[model samples]
Target: MIDFITGRGLLLLSLRRMYELWVNHSSQIIKQFSILIGLPLEMSNNSDSSLEVFSPAKFPKAMNELSALLEAIAATSIYFKAEIVVSYIKSHSLRIEWIEANPALAKIVTSGLLKTFSLETLFEANRNNKNFLRDVENHISKQLLAG
Candidate 1:
């Protein structure tokens, strides 16, 4: 899926741009791109405090810009931090549906990242399962058991 998605020119361009924009842009660069081109992507990193914020926006008329950026971040986060994301997904089953809904996500979260969002991912069965929606049918029929 990653190969297929990157095959598309626009999606490919968006991926490259996301990689390029991880760091916050300088003021002059922001003014030139944000004002002139209508892409205002900013990521702040503070050494004093362990906090990072991502702000990416597009013109009001455009719809997919922010979605694509956010999808990219989700993809990369899953790619880089599979364990954390996978655990979160397990506790929140709907999260996988959200990930699967996005074409960019299906494409970007390739390689082993696909496993991170798969419904089959096994999670620890503990107190956290309290809120875990049991969408998967756990029942086995008598016919199947006999077979």
Candidate 2:
């Protein structure tokens, strides 16, 4: 029984290690793949300057890291999406505050995403669903990807 327990612990450790390696490799691949696809795609909209994609011109490393991090986020499960989004919001609340100061821009971003996802029509259907966080993340992911 002790030997069995030890084997099971080792297996769990190995699985965790594999997962870590996979995430690291995947992040690296995304970094490279995005570059190959001619990254830093320019996005513009008249309505919202705050929602504008982060400028690679100012923070190239941040741009790369955010891109890879967002890709990993996209691949995450719905249950964790809300947790991640909430954590992100908590961490970046200052940015959100600044963006919200320009209400028009926030409106444009929310409206544009709602239109793109057609959530404007069906928001009531899934507004309370746990997966809504996942939807929000996907929207943010798109905006980041546009950079």
* Root-mean-square deviation per candidate: 18.9, 16.8
Model 1 lDDT, full chain set = 0.35
Superposed on all Cα atoms, model 1 deviates from the true structure by an RMSD in Å of 18.9
Q: Which 10-residue span in candidate 1 carries the lowest summed lDDT?
A: 135-144
Query: Using Cα atoms with residue i matched to residue i, what is each candidate's TM-score against the true structure?
Result: 0.18, 0.23
Q: Write the per-residue lDDT of candidate 2 for residues 23-86, one digit (tens) a residue.
A: 7798687567545443433335634433443333533443444445445445433333333333
Winning model by lDDT = 2
Stretches of candidate 1 off by over 4 Å are: 1-88, 91-101, 114-122, 131-147
